[model samples]
Target: MTVFRLIITLLATSILGATEGVVTSNSVRLTDGETLASAMDKGALALNMGDVTFIAGYRQVTSIRQDPIIMRFDGQGSDAVKTWQRTDIDATAVDSRAVGLIWDGYERLYVLITVDGGSNDAGTVRRFTNNGWLRDYGSGGGPKVTVALRVDPNTGTPDTGTYIRARLSNGNTNSAVPTAIAFHGDTLVVQLSSFFSPLRVDRQRMTHDTGPSPFPWRVVFDPSLANARRSEAVNFDGVVDIPELPSRQVRLMVGDHEDASATVIVNQTVVARPSGSILDSGIYDPAAPCSFQLHDSIPSSLQ
Candidate 1:
């Protein structure tokens, strides 16, 4: 038997932070009031809409309050795009943090949000059309509830209304929280997990079922945000992180173990293919091969 180990190390060569490069049209520069450093300090995220840049971040109002803000700047007039506000439904303890912004390249701009609902958090996907945000998406015009769908063997257009607001929760109110979200082609991949001690699924215990430990699971949704398909418990016992790949396939980092194993979910199918291992000090050991470092870099271009 051959074991494939995967390891990724992000290095920073600057004292300011880690630097990421994005090539955009010259017209897509930030206004004078905002700089790249300031955006990074605010934990802002930017998405390119046409030639313009759509920035999403939050402003700290009080210790327990934050206002989600969006800015549409094209080196010009008004930087304020729109202000978004949502009161907790049923007044049952709700807090939100912007996870990402998704644009369909035509009209819809989706905002991925995680709602902290005291005990169990939810992964909410909201849609903003050309007019404004769609408030009446779910029931009486709010977040659409999660439903069980027939898992199709292949992909096809969903037969339901466009899911302007979709929330992912599997009834486990104790800990089912959405940790991260990303786009796998046109499909949305959401990483979800509960609050419990995880039973590590290392090379030694891959065959045995680790029972009901908090191993991160995934839910894949189509472009409409409807027709969700859940995946099996990933063997690697860690929070799933979806990194960008040239192939645009969903890369699931196994866990923060020395083995550094990973599986790829291609297209919309849940498949695990172990990427090859590395030779560390000319010896083979599953628990001695993974290392990670985060470097926060500020771009000098100020865009």
Candidate 2:
């Protein structure tokens, strides 16, 4: 999908037989100012002359210089998702993450990562051109969001959705709720799943307000996917097999738990404001003097 320009020898240090040839330290590289997002999203490729080291599913999370303490990319039976080999700067490996897409603009392939959130990790969003230069942005190489198909809120038809892959949060590693997500276009929608909080209006609260959702509404899987937009068909189990796709454009509100995390996922192009945005904000006011339900329910998760 991308080509190599030049690469740093150090970047090649992690190549355990994964590239065509190893990029030596003497390799000239592009300037650092070129943002990682622009490079990968633009179509940059690292220098991998011809080594078969790059397998489909290889991943890890830990300190780069300290060796990976955690890694995963194998599939379960026939349902496992395939992945690419990613090697960003050593310091960029501070958290659990995965490289999703690679788009290069200037004779290089850009690289992006999906990071795990926690008390220690700030999550990541690193980028590297074909030559293996590093540029950090969009969380620590974190995956952006993409694609969503919500209801009409009134008729329950195909309202519309966005595809910001960066919106989904998997730091839960066990399916925690992504607080908010952008639509397939340029909107946001969120689902408050299960949590330990008793005061917060979670799924139960959602049911009390509306009725129920097709699924639990808050239970999402935390899988290792790079460029979710490109691989969404596989994850969503709704499309045919395809090749690596363009990177998604989205962001995650950093934190954990209710008083800690800010995970959210949008299913449409309209921002779900319990209260609208600042211009006419009054949708989320539990005490607002308004008259609107805002949502409908399905048959599940209703107790």
Candidate 3:
């Protein structure tokens, strides 16, 4: 059997620290001054609406907290385009679940939504900025709750549109899932499962910026992998920083790669092996919780 390995080294400064938290309940309460209208202008309020939760890391809250309360934002303002209605959607009707919240160094908020209904397992990510909400591209037919957010090297801020990478399972007999994503400045590195093609890493520059008008997020892939439909892998249950790199590095694991196992290392280590091969792996940081259906398949070693 032949194995393909691709290694690329990038020169970058250490990664910045970020505030992280999760919202599992809808009991979050808001104070009198914490209405959506006021919070929108202040850009420093954390509110939870049903399955959606908003966290304002710019406010520099000493600690993260989710209170129980009912709050509403009535329509206001003449912008017409700017309605007081909240953009944080409640997906309970469809049985969707909130994975977690990530605050990048620039204080950009990214929310992961996992939809695991009788039909399919898929997900969507919403980026919250002072300007407004920016939705991201997502997959269908498989569980895609795993995600990773990296700072936009161009502006050094995520609001300007940070690099958002996600993975989903294709339910194929062969293990094909998005493995890892890494950002060094403006360049983005993405890894996915490829059946016929040789083992290789692809790079592309994409613009995730949004305007006042509604628009969907765009992802530009390297032309070489344009036909690589095997991007889907097992859902990632968690993410953590590689101790060696400490900063600017993260390891994502797919609990089970179709009975076999697999791992993707972004920035430093990128390896490709046949499906079902086992390798030494890192621990999953509970800080970054992901929603997927492969929980029962996680190897006993990783558990």
Question: lDDT for every model?
Answer: 0.33, 0.21, 0.27
Model 2: lDDT of residue 290: 19
In angstroms, the error of model 2 at 244 is 10
Full ranking by lDDT: 1, 3, 2
Clashing pairs in 1: 5-277, 17-297, 18-296, 18-297, 136-141, 137-141, 138-142, 138-143, 138-144
* Candidate 3 per-residue C-alpha lDDT over 49-82 given as tens digits, one digit per residue, 9 for 90 to 100: 3433343321111244221122223234322121
Count backbone overlaps in model 2. Answer: 69
The best candidate by TM-score is 1
> CA RMSD for every model?
16.8, 23.3, 20.3
Using lDDT as the yardstick, the better of models 1 and 3 is 1
Stretch of 10 with least lDDT, candidate 1: 149-158
Cα lDDT of model 1 by residue, 1-303, tens digit: 333233323322221111111211111212225543455445467766444555544444456644344454444234433222222211223343443454433333444443333222231222221121222222222221211111111121112212122222332223334444454434455454533322111201122235554445455455454444323234433324322222211223324343224322222232223343221111113233233211222211100
- Tens-place lDDT per residue, model 2, 180-254, is 221222212222222211011111111122222212221111111111211121112232221221122222221
Number of clashes recorded per candidate? 9, 69, 12
Q: Residue 79 CA error for candidate 3 (Å)? A: 27
